[model samples]
Target: MQTIYIDADACPVKIEAERVATRLGVRMVLVSNGGIRPSDNPLVESVYVASGPDEADKYIAEACGPGDVVVTGDIPLAAKCVAAGAKVVKHNGEELHERNIGNVLATRDLMQDLRSADPFRQGGGRPFSKTDRSRFSEVLDRLVRQAKR
Candidate 1:
């Protein structure tokens, strides 16, 4: 069975992902440390892992496999899920797979190194916008439909 695994910590599109999963009749697992309200929908499952960095990521990477769709912004976690044959998508609608995971990881590492090299460098991405939300919904819907096949 195809499932949607969401790395829910700091995720901006939880409700959108849930809507897509529910509409597609796919099981959606929200992994986090805490602070997430449990969903009443049977198709949605809220999984709270131990408190720590990457605990939720670890769970998501280990649990997701082929035929699963993983939603995460952590590049390393996305790489792992892609390696495990799961389709990975970022909150902004970027799809990570075999074709580009290497470059994505390398870019992420380079950015981290550059940030570490400069103490004054600001660390943050652009704010989430309405366009991003729309793109995420469309991409998620498409991925779920593809996974169902």
Candidate 2:
């Protein structure tokens, strides 16, 4: 059966993903290092990993396989999930598959390099908007439906 694995640290669409998973009858796993409330819903499973960098990512990457869907903004985790044959979606609703994972990983590495080389060059991405939430919901719904079949 297909499952939805969410890298839940700082994830904005947790509720949305849960709703979709519940509606679609697919299991949704929210992996975090703690601080997230465990859901009462039977369809949702909240996994708390040890408090350390990438612990949740490691869990998701190792558990997910073909027909599974992963939701994360971490480019490296997304690349790993994609390589493991799972479908990956960014927080902003972008899909990262085998065809584009390399480019996305490269761009992320380039940005990290630029940031480290220039400490003063510090600026984060735009704030999450309602439109992004809507897009994510739609895309996630579509992906889950596809995974079910």
Candidate 3:
């Protein structure tokens, strides 16, 4: 049984994720640090971890294993999930597999280093768009179908 684990701390696609998981009949777990509302859907549940920076990430990683799907924007968490044989999808709907995890992690580290070096540096990432939601919906549907196989 493949489950969907979401890093809900800073994720912007919770509603979309819930809708997809419900439609796909996959159990969805939203892990957070107590900031998110509890879901009423029996298939969707929210797991609030202890208040810590990486507690939510740790819980998500520990709960997922092979054949599971994880949605997260955290590059390190995505890399860890991929290494654990779980499929990872970014909030932007990009899939991260073994082939590209290294490059993603490297780029994330490089950006972190740059930010640390220049305190004034800021991330240039744009706000999530409707296109992103559409892409995510399509990719998530595909992934759910694949997981059922």
Candidate 4:
């Protein structure tokens, strides 16, 4: 059976992911420490892991497999899921695949190093917009349909 595993911490599209999962009849598990509210949807399950730094990440990675769809922005977790044969997608609708996971992981490491080296570097991404939400819905719809096959 296929499932959708969501790294719910700081994820902007949890509701959207639930909608797609519910519509597709796929089981969706939301893994987090304790911040996420439980979902009322039958197809959705909210999993609260221990309050360790990567407990949720470890749980999601261990549960995800060949027929799973993982939603997360954590590049390392995405890389691990991709290695485990699951299809991974970012909240902004970017699909992380085998073809590009390596480069993405490397760049993530590089960026982390740069950030740690510079104490004055303090910036974040643009606000998540309505257009991004729409795009994520479209990509998730397509991915769920493909996973169902």
Candidate 5:
């Protein structure tokens, strides 16, 4: 059966993903490093990994496979999931398929390089907006339905 694995550390659409998964009768696993409260919903399982970098990401990557959907903002993890044949979505609902994964990965690496090279290069990303959340919900809903089939 298809499952939705969420890299929940910095994800903003946890609740939205849960709602969609519950409605679609799909299983959703929220993997974190222990700060998130476990959900009471039986369909929603919270897997708290050891406190370390990429522990949750490793777990999710190992478990996810074809027909599985993963939600994450980490570009490396997204690429891993995609290579494993799972469909991946960003927090803002951007789908990262095989066709775009390479470009996305390269861009992310480039951006990281720029940041490291320029310590004074200020400016965090924009705050997540309602429209972004709405788009995520819609895209997640569609992906979940497709995975079910």
Candidate 6:
């Protein structure tokens, strides 16, 4: 059976994922580092890791394999999932595949380096919108169906 793995520490699409998973009768796991509430839904399980940077990401990556769907905004985690043959989708609906994972990781690292070089340098990111949620739902449905096959 296929499972949906969510990097839920700072993910904004947890509710969206749950709605889609419930509708599709799919199992979902939310991996966190001790901040979110545990889900009461029988189909949804929460796995809390030790409170440390990247602990949740490590757990999520280690737990996922082929035929799994991982939702994460972290570029490195997304790359890892893609390399593991697991389908990866960002909360904003972008699909991460082998073709683009390297570029994504490089861009993320470049931005981090730029920010670290200058304390006052501010990195800009767009806020999640309803349209993003809709796109994610649609893409997730498609990915889930593909995973099932």
Backbone steric clashes in candidate 4, count: 0
TM-score of model 2 (CA atoms):
0.97
Instruction: Encode model 4's per-residue lDDT on 1-149: one tens digit a residue.
Output: 89999999899999899888878889999999998989888888889999989999999999998889999999999999999999999999989999999999999898888889997875767988999888888898887788777
> Which stretches in model 4 have alpha-carbon errors above 4 Å?
none
Best by lDDT: 1
Q: Give the TM-score of candidate 1.
A: 0.97
Candidate 6 has a TM-score of: 0.94
Tens digits of lDDT, candidate 5, 1-149:
78999999889999999999999988999999989989999999999999998999999999999999999999999999999999999999899999999999999888888989999975778888999899999999998878777
Model 1 per-residue lDDT tens digits across residues 83-143 = 9999999999998999999999999999999999998886688988999999999999998
Q: Which stretches of candidate 1 lie over 4 Å from their true place?
A: none
For each predicted model, how many residue pairs clash, with residues at least 3 apart or on different chains? 0, 0, 0, 0, 0, 0
The local distance difference test score of each candidate is: 0.93, 0.92, 0.88, 0.90, 0.93, 0.90
Can you give the TM-score per candidate against the true fold? 0.97, 0.97, 0.95, 0.95, 0.96, 0.94
**Ten-residue stretch with the least lDDT total in model 6:** 120-129
The Cα error of candidate 2 at residue 35, in Å, is: 1.0
lDDT of 6 by residue, 8-76 (tens): 988898998998899889999999887789888899999988988899889888888888999999998
User: In model 6, which regions exceed 4 Å deviation?
Assistant: none
Positional deviation of residue 135's Cα in model 6 after best superposition, in angstroms: 1.0
lDDT of 3 by residue, 33-69 (tens): 8879889999998888899788988887777888789
Instruction: Kindly indicate the candidate among 1 and 4 with the higher TM-score.
Output: 1
Candidate 3 achieves a global lDDT of 0.88
